[model samples]
Target chain A: MNGVHDMGGMDGFGRIEPERDEPVFHAPWEGRVMAMMRAMGCVGGWNLDMFRNARESQPPSFYLTASYYKSWEKTLETLLLERGLVMEEEIVASRSFSGSTVAGQPLRAEDVSKALKRQSYERSTSAAALFKVGDGVRTRNIHLPTHTRLPRYARGRRGTIERVHGCHVFPDSSAVGAGDDPQWLYTVVFDGSELWGTDDDPSLKVSVEAFEPYLEAL
Target chain B: MTLRVRALETVLLEKGLIDPAVLDLIVEAYETRIGPRNGAKVVARAWLDPDFKRALLEDATAAVSSLGHVGEIGDHLIAVENLPTLHNMVVCTLCSCYPTDLLGLPPVWYKSAPYRSRVVRNARGVLAEFGVNLPPEMEIRVWDSTAETRFLVLPMRPAGTEGFDVDALASLVTRDSMIGTGLPKLPEVGP
Candidate 1:
């Protein structure tokens, strides 16, 4: 989705102005939202890709104005509403819906650490690794409204494979309720000049993890 | 926002989807247990011991996990070391994907538009604003972290600390330094 979150090149936002010794959550609500998201994630209502897509699919204007966790809360609402976990009227009334269908297992307090560490994405398909380190590849110029790990700025650009990360969960298919569709993931390095043209400093380069489907022989 | 979050929590609680106790546990984990100190310790150990550094460089997950610091966004971390010729920094151009287990939640600026959008093309400029003015000849590499695999920048240690131990060295490793936005703290004033 071409949402405000795909902010890779366009400018006009002010200085980064990072806080000194930043906390995990600025306000207490942010932590609650994170906890809620974690608990909801355990409910198996949707995959992480779906949660990402839901946030990315938000109105650009609203997404821009909203804070980070605010966006998460909004996405949580959308997911719950879409999955029939809660009703719209109930949300408006601050009341719990009686017919909510949250039947999946809850992330119990004791299981929080385990749940956080679990990595369920890796799998080996009969498919062998396509590109090796140092192989030249180009990111497939793609623009889709659904979901993609490929950034808009890196699209159609040429890069050299830095490392073969082996097969991992493919986000494109996973976002739409499809299987992991394990694909070869590569850390491809592109010269900044290749991405931003001659104006960019030659000393600059960017590396992105491009799945097999997002690449083609350059 | 709190009202909305509270409402949602109420819904989930009432629906029996989640327990309030679990929410508090998650919050506490992010708040105290996980933080930049974790990454700092890793970086300090790497600086102190060459074998661990090589292990971290070869397979970050196993090396990091051996330290009992496993999970969260550190699920599949790739620790990129900053060297004299090559400088490494991380950003999530698409979204703010970070190794929360190692570095805790990212600073707000990392998720902002300026840092996310400009770092790819204008890393020097971005670094300049962060007070990191790299030499023109040194190459800069910006890493884009994804949900499955997050990247952490193992900032090079500063000179003049010949006798510093891991604990002392870790103090020099700030959060921004590990992110490649700011340099590690300078040597303390001589006694």
Candidate 2:
């Protein structure tokens, strides 16, 4: 699905220049590591059921596997290893795609791979709780990285707690691959005028599911 | 989960736990398949039936479930019908928790931070961006969907759309129509 960013082509308001250079570079084996980490993170964070169901179906194109990363090196490595097309150690030592060096030593394929995986896991697990379901609350407009169900328009807006949908998946900054941590999920309800002002129709009301961090006690 | 979603995916790829190919599939499935067709049905029905439309304005959930969509938000699903005297739009305000069961996934703009933040503050101006020019006399009701009660917009039945069946009427109810920015038009009025 095209996001707001993807709508750049629709009108003059959203246009952005495409990057001249490619965005990622990693070996095939290294790429598999990243794919696995993401899948695990998503399953653990947002929809574990989706991950399990996808695995059972064994759909060739499921995003839970390593073959789909864009970097050629990662794709090749995952294919060779998962399909047994190549030995494990052969690609580990190769450094053809090295973009930088750390600690005065060229970063090994394994070291970079490990760092990426660690980062993914850390993001899915962190978030502080400030409120709960059934509590009268208001939204805060502060922006941060990690998954947050709160919509932008409702910030600082008052609403009532509808339900504490047990901790489900968080979609804050981390859900999108940013470095931020996870947040709790809650459903909030708002009056028509609270959002649309006095001109709003009296007959209608809006309800939405949001994360805990995006809200505060009213 | 835009930037962080990507960043996390990158980290996972480096970890060798998941396959990047699978991630693409997940993204594709969500983007292409799981979206707002559910709510389009409601918008279509309201555009076609007067009795059902009346029922929706009075009690939206029952009216919608009559067509077979048990909303997933909570037990009490609220359907805000937009009328001539009043116009209603929905926004997550915090994120994009739309009535997927009735509407499917929200459109890209519906989930935007700009749309989410500004619509409630300057709804008239925002609607204008979508080419929705409303008279000042028309009340603009914006429903903030939070909590367990999900929301779907019941757009007004367009003029010149008489005699259309539910399916045909639904075909005219695009996602935007339910968002309160656009209205379903009769076949002759469409470009």
* Number of the top-ranking candidate, with TM-score as the measure: 1
Give lDDT tens digits, candidate 2, residues B117-136: 55655667677777678877
lDDT of 1 by residue, A54-151 (tens): 99999988888888998888998899889878888887777785955655667887788876654657777898888899999999999887888899
> How many angstroms is residue A181 displaced in model 1 relative to the true structure, after the best TM-score fit?
0.9
DockQ, each predicted model: 0.70, 0.09
Candidate 1's DockQ is 0.70
For model 1, which pairs clash? A8-B117
TM-score of each model, in listed order: 0.97, 0.48
- Distance from true position, residue B89, model 2, in Å? 0.9
Name model 1 segments beyond 4 Å from true. Answer: A118-120, B69-74
CAPRI-wise, candidate 1 is medium
Per residue, candidate 2 scores C-alpha lDDT tens digits across A12-127 of 33311222332222233333343343444432332322222222233333322322233223333343344342334434432223221121322233343232221211123444
lDDT of 2 at A216: 80
